[model samples]
Each structure stands twice: as C-alpha cells, then as structure tokens.
Target: MLEKVYPPFIFNEFDRKNKFGLFMDVEKVIYSGVTKFQRIDIFETKAFGKVFTLDGVPMTCELDEFVYHEMISHVPLFLHENPKKVLVIGGGDGGTVREVLKHPSIEKVIMCELDEEVVEATKKYLPNLSYELNNPKVHLVFEDGSKFIKNFNNEFDVIIIDSTDPTEGGGGALYTESFYQDCFKALTENGVFTAQTEEPFIEKEWMIRAYKRISSVFNVAKLYLGFVPEYTPGTWSWTFASKNIDPIKDFNPEKVRNFDKELKYYNEEMHVASFALPNFVKKMIKDI
Candidate 1:
C-alpha cells in the first residue's frame, strides 16, 4: 500500500494496484507508472470526483488545468494591443507558457520556475499539455520569481503568475504584498499582471486578502472565475491587478481570433461575464 498525506485531508490506505482509501475525507485512485518520476494521485469522489496528481502519476480524479491556464494567460495578453514581452511565474509545467505563446504578437516569453524537477516531470509525463516549451520565444529560468522581478525594470507588457495554491511550500511567497509591488515595478506603464487566486469556496478569505494587497499596489484590480477540478472543491478563482489599463476595454475579439484558433472558453462576451461574480462572493470581497 502507498501512503501519502495531503492538507485538509488524509490518505490512509492503498490497494495493491491503483485504489486508495481516505480517512473519512474522500476516496482516491492512484496511477503508478514511470515517465520521469514515481507519483501518486488523489481524487475526491464527492466533488466532481476530481483528480489531483503528484510527481508523475495520474491520481484517482482529474482536473482540467487547461481552462484556468488559458483564461489567466490569454485575458491579459489578448487585452494588450501588441504584447511583445511576457513573464510567467511558477508555471513549471509549461501550460501557461504554451498559451502565452499562442499570440503571434508576442516576441519573447520568460518563464521563472522555482523547481526544475517539476518542469522535468511535467515535460516527461504531460507532454501534450506542455508542448509549448519547445517554442523559440520561451526562456525558462529556474530561480525565485520574486527576486527576478525586483531587478527587472519596466520590462514586460504582461505578467502572469500561474502558481500552485499558497499553502504549498515554496509557493507561499507568491501571495505576499512585496511580490505584487515587484510585479508593479516590473511592468511597463500600461502593463498588466494576473495570478491564480484560490478556490472561492475554500480559500475565500485568503483570496480577498491577496486582492486587497494587490489593490494597494496597482491601480486596477479584478477577480474572475473558471472551473478547474484538480484544486479543492471544484471552482477556481483568478485575480488580476494592473498598473494602468482597463482589461476589458482593451480587448477586441476579432484581433485575438486572428492570433489563435484553439481557444474554447474566452471570447469577448465571456471576458466581461467572468468578472460578474455571484452575490455571495461579491459580498465576501466587496471591501477589497
């Protein structure tokens, strides 16, 4: 039996092959194989039977990383008239970079990942999702993104932080106020920055706190939602903070369609609609 523990939940026992039992928390399915590294996956049967992966194996349930990655990367990129340079923080899987490079107008993309193992693991096992790493425009940097941004000076037209949940180790700094300040300083006058906030259903308070801190540093702050199953619950939230520029006003569907044809979720109408949060969530973050 395989033994692993996750926060907010616990994995108790594993089947000889691919099943697992949770401690009254949830049920999990495990996939064991070798592409790069050994891995374990957990799924919550009640919540869309969502699957979460660790290391290199497919967990009991599955969540779509694409929907969130596309929305976060394209929203700011499509809004910009011609985004020549972009920065992605913590998306070592290359999913975010893959989407960012879809725009023909983008000349350079710098991805700063804290873990090289994560990059290698994803590249080996999740090849289809990480196909964009081969693009000539992408420059991968394995280091601390916060430190990298501090030295950068007005260099990017768009910045996207496609990171893991804040509770995860090494990812905690991504939610800090100083990180937002550095993001503000790293952008051009009209540049925009966006990040993957947590699930409104579970981490609403922390999400709002992050929004408030970002609001203090950037002139414009916006929160939006998309459904991702791998994360806690099922719904995921993303927050955007900009130095100067109304993200919605800057978008034109016709122009974005010219760049890529693979997008399924983001359109001009959806762009505006996503910002319309439910009254419950609205009330929760209203002050922020």
Candidate 2:
C-alpha cells in the first residue's frame, strides 16, 4: 500500500487559550509579505475564493463578502432619507466602497486606509473587490483612520468603519471611546456611523466594551448581526450609532425595496431580522 499525503492546512489562532481555531486549505499564495503596519497575505482557498488576511486573521473573501459589505452599507443608508457624502475607514480591500457605490444618491466616497500596501495588494490580486476603488466618485486616502475624522465636522452622511479586529495590529485605537466621539463629531445631522464589532461568541468582552463605548457617544446605539463564514464561529456583529436617526423605528423598507442594485445576502426582510438579536446577545448588550 502507498501512503497518501495532503497539502498542509492553514490554521487561524482565534482563541489561543482554548486552542480553538479555524483552518482553510490554501490552494496558492498570490502574495505574502510584511507591510509597514501588518503582515498581509493574499491566497486562494478551496472553500472561499481569493482571501485577504492581516496578521494571520481572515479579513474578507470573495465567496461571502457581499453579506458583510452590503449589510454594513445598506442598513444605515436605507434608514437615512438621502445620503450624499460617504466616508469609509480602514477598508483597504474596497469591498465596502463597492457596496457604497451601489446607491445612486451617493455623490462621493472617501476611503481612508492606514496602509497603502494593502490597497496596492488588493488592486493587484483582488480586482473583483478593488475594481471600484478607482471609480470617479471614490477618493482613496492613505492615512490613520483615528486621526482622519478629526479634520471633518458635519461632513459625511454615513461613516463605515470596515476595520480588522481591534486587538490585531494597529486597529486597537479605532475601537476606543475617543475615536467613537470623533466619529460622532464628523457626521452630519442625520448621519449614521457603524463599525464591525467583534463576534460575541468568541470575544464577548470586546463586544460589550465596544457597545458601551459607542452607546455612550451616540444618542442611539444598536448592535446587529451578520453571518460571515470566514469569521470565527461563522457569525459577526456590527455596531450602529446615530446622532438622531433610530435604526429600527425610522428605517424605511421602501427605500431598500426600491434600490436598483442586485444584492446577494442583504434584503429588506434581512435588514429587519438582522437587528433581532438572540437571547444571549440581547443579554450581553443589555447591561453594557
């Protein structure tokens, strides 16, 4: 009998203490190197298409990215009556920008990314996500996100923080209370602000802390869930904060129903359902 061998699997150490992690079969490495801020890896996986990872953590992939990008952009967009100017912070891959461009009413989108190399890598290897980054209405700014918003007040209609996990590399400052205050000051009167809050199933304390901080800054703060298979535990959360708009009570489903773009994961019903939290998640954010 002949012995069989398989390619090695790549494991992401999401929970180091418990030794819990997720693995993907890497087909090929498109690009791998240490950028100025963090380690960037672009690889083709058997399960998902080309994936972008920072510091050994899965960020986004071609397969299930629409679920995350659409939910993050469209939820607050539809809730707000007319969103003209948009700002995206730390989404170097351009997935969030692509989704933001779907709304016809948007006049401009400014994407502020900390690392220029990440944008270069995405533009080279991940064209599907990065193609829209060059659109006429999109402006790419390579700078620190925490400091970028300080220059603006009553500017953007919607601000999306499509950043990596807070503890990973330099993204920790993005989740701070002061940064949330800056985001609150940067938005217009009816502006909506949102960020990718960590998965509660794996990082409960982080989620609670983020929720408390955001709640304290914004007049109305709420947490929503989305299913991103690439993320640990197959679940992800996003924090939505607004100066005046109520995400649920003020949400207009007709705006979403009238959206011309073809969406994959997010829909009118899912928009409402996404806000309905499970018992544990409700309990987690209740006292925070």
Candidate 3:
C-alpha cells in the first residue's frame, strides 16, 4: 500500500532552505515506495492534479508538464531535418516520448529509463503522460541510460536526455563528461542532442559544467529556456549540442507552420525565442 499524506504537503527544492508547500483542498497519496534507484511518490492535489516526486523533490506535475515536455522534445527534433530514430534517456514518465511521437517524422523512439518502477508507478497514477509508452513506435528499455547509449554508434538522429538533477540522489554519471562523449558518438552526422539542464538561478555551477562539457564534445552547443512552473523559480533550461547542425540556422519554419499535431507550448516563434538567453546565462557559457 502507498503511504498516505494529508493536506499541507510541503514540496521541497534545492535544500530545506528553499521550498514550496501547498495546502491542498483535496489530496491523496496514490503510491509511495523506495525504488531501486530512488524513493518514488505519486500523489494527487487539487492544484496540480497528479504530481510525481523522486527523492522528496517534485519532478513533474500534470498542470504544467506540457511546457517542459514540449520545449525539450521539439527544440532538437525540429532542428533535425528528418528525425526518424530517437533515443530518450531517463524519461520514465513517458511525457518526453509522448511529445516526441507527435512528429510524424519520428519512426522509432527508444526510451531508456534506469528504473522500471518509475514507469509502472507513472503508468498507473499518471495515465495521460505514460499512455504513449505503449505505442507501437515506442520501445521501452530498462537500463542505466549512460551505459545503454555507449553500445550505439551513429545510430540515432536525435537524442533527448530527460534526466533528473545531478545532486546526491539524482542522476550522477548521466551529467558526466563521459556520458556526453558517449552521446556524441551515438548520434549520427547532423544529429541533434538536448538535455534538461538545471535551472540557472539555483543550479548555476551545474549548468555551467554541463555547458562546458557538451561544448567540448559537440561543434555547436547552445542553451534554451522554458517556463516550467513546477520547478523552482518558474524558469528551467535545456542544453542543445549538435554534431553539425545549428539549431537556429537549421530550424525548419515551414515544418512548424505545417505541423499536423496539436501543440500547446512550442511553435516557430517560440523556437527562435527559446534560444535567446539572458545576458547572465550568455556570459556563463560564453567562454565554453
């Protein structure tokens, strides 16, 4: 049975010093347990509907997930001319895969998640997000993503690293230089790669390190911003690295205009705007 929590559940972030708590009008703990990788909790609140937390940190919620999922999936995808084969690392919730499948150009999507428990819990508690995991075009693989991608060479046209934070219980090796090198090797020529880089306000050093490492491996490295309300400060960033494609210069505006799928957050103008980073972030990654 899942552990139950009452109203006024506190959702902590960074440290106990910075946190966001909500006193829900209605609340129910759908599932809670310690998975092999980390502690998992799925709960429903009046404000966010269904919320998924890992290691006591709120990862994603139903209300504002579209902003994060759309930005992360579409930015690199539309940048690539024909993203037929794609790999998603650590998106067990299936939101990334859901967004990726919206592109008719995508033929196969392999979602390599480290923990199957996260997949199961989300599938039961958050059906809307995890429904795409069963799609014929989607292949679910349970393995350490960093190790899984190393076996491939020039195989995927786009790689999306929807990993957790790189803190103590968060994704450790997934943020390392070695993993970026493996990602570089796994992507084909003209392939584009993007990862969920930490928020600059709270994770400045971590973001800088990721930017530098990705820049060292790929010819074109860029950073883009998204408004994920569930995350701290309401602003989150994604890092893009490409072997040969420049995300902005190589973007297909026609594809965006003619896209058949219904989109909530990302569009052609938003694509161009996402790349326009603040001066502080610009200076941070400028040297790299």
Candidate 4:
C-alpha cells in the first residue's frame, strides 16, 4: 500500500483552513472496478433490490434484467409462426433462454456466452435470472458470438443478441456491420433477430448508423424502446431485423405458456406501445 506523510510546512498550511472538519467513519466497499468491468449488487430498495450499482453506476442485477431478457426473447418468438430453433448471443445470465423456453413451439435454444465468469457470477448472485441454465432444451456455448454466427447457415428462427454496450471491448463486434451480416446469415427465411441497442437519448448517432446497416441487409429493420431503469437515461432501445417478417404484424402472445406471473415491465399493451416511438425519435430515423 502507498502512503504519504505530511511535512510540518504542509500540515501548518492545511490547518489554516477554517472549513476543514474532522474525518468521519468510512464504510465498507462492496464492489469496485474500471469500465471494462465492475461489480454490482442486486438487492437495493430504490431499484427494487433487483439490480445494483457499483462505483455509482448500475452494471447488472435482477430487478431490471427480466425486462430486457423477456422482451428480446419473447417478442420474436411470439411473432414467429413456428419458432422451433433459437440462438442467443452474449446472454450469459441465461435470462433470455429462460424466457424462450416458456414458448411451446421452441424445441432447442442455443446460447453463446463469451465469459463463463458472467454465467457463474449471475448464477451465484442472481439465481432468479440464471435458473434455466441447465434446462434440457438449452445448450450453452462458451465462444465468441459474432464468429459463431458466421458458421451458422440460416438454421434459426430467431437470434437474440443480449449483449452489453459495445463500448466494452468484448461486446464491440456485436455493433458492427459485419456482425449484422453474420446474423443475417444465421437466420432462416422469415427469421427475426433482436438486440439491445444503446440508450436512445445518449446514442442517437450510433443508433441511426446501426439501423441503416441492418436495413441494408434485411427487408425490414425496426427500432423499439423498453424501459429498464438500471441502464442510463432510464429507458433503453432494442433493434430488430427480419428476413421477411414485419415485427409489428408478427406479434402473437397467446402462445406463451408456463407464465412465471412475475413480470414487471412487459405486457400485451406494453408490447404494442413499445413500437410507438415519440415524434423526435421518428424524426431521427426518418431522415436516415
């Protein structure tokens, strides 16, 4: 440990400050890390003890995890007429796979999580979200998501990219045009893919660019918003691309079975409302 001792001259100058007060007690540090990664706790009241923040920023937790997981997984599943096979990229928590299994039509769900540590962490601290990791229909792949999609040949009905912000180095490829092309290849005809885009308020420029790239590859590309407080600016955005399906017309929630009865954010009304963006958001995409 590094320490410093104050010299007599410096101590004399510091003592001259009238605003100075005696030191108070220090508290325990729960979690700490740099931007590439950080620690978070999931049981704080203000956020419903669902999610936790470390170093003053929310990283991951249970409270708001279901919102993103359920929305990204079920939206495309509900829309598809027969979603037999599915692939998930970067959802190490297994929350997305858990929701996908609720659908009767799904036969197999393969997930590619680069970090086994993330899976281990979420399983230890967020059991509610990680419970379905060992389900029979679920197959875990410890590998690179972007690269994994390249070898896949139109074998899936839906591909959900539950990735972190691309600003993180490991998640960076998920935001690129090349990755979108790989996703395009990985989907069967009429297959749809959805991903959590960055905060719309903070990343308007990047959002526009992402939409343009997706549109170029697929016949339909759409952006939708869902509220997840743990993320920045309170709300978040998700982007979808489909070979032949229009996400709005493809919604069919009557198919979801084994309902958990614990969802806080997603519902039929919220499903329809999520696609309805405000005028300013419309303006940003219209020009592009």
Please name the candidate that would achieve the greatest TM-score relative to the true structure. Answer: 2
Per-candidate local distance difference test: 0.71, 0.86, 0.86, 0.70
TM-score of each: 0.80, 0.94, 0.93, 0.80
List all candidate RMSDs to the true structure.
6.0, 3.9, 2.5, 8.6
**3 or 4: which has the higher lDDT?**
3
- Tell me the spans in candidate 2 whose CA falls farther than 4 Å from its real position: 1-7, 13-18, 168-171
Instruction: Put the candidates in TM-score order, highest first.
Output: 2, 3, 1, 4
Compute the lDDT for candidate 2: 0.86
Over 4 Å off, model 1: 5-63, 168-171, 257-259
lDDT string for model 1 (1-288, tens) is 235444345443222222532232445443333333334343454543444455422222324666777889888887777789999998877778878887888899999987776677567656656688878898999888878888798999999987755643333788898999999989999788899887576546677877777888899998888766554455778888787777677667787656545876777777778888998889888865
Error of 3 at 28 (Å): 1.6
TM-score of candidate 2 on Cα atoms, chains taken together:
0.94
lDDT (tens digit, per residue) of candidate 4 on 1-288: 101121111111122232331121112323222333433333333334544333233445555777887788777777778889999998877788888887777899999987776676667766787888888888889888888888899899999988766553333788888899889888999788897776567646667777777778878888888877656556778888898888777776554433455556677767778889998888988898
Q: Give the TM-score of candidate 3.
A: 0.93
Worst 10 residues of 1 by lDDT: 13-22
Residue 138's lDDT within candidate 4 is: 87
lDDT of 1 at 186: 91
Q: Which regions of candidate 3 deviate over 4 angstroms?
A: 1-6, 17-26, 169-171
Clash pairs, candidate 1, are 41-59, 51-61, 51-62
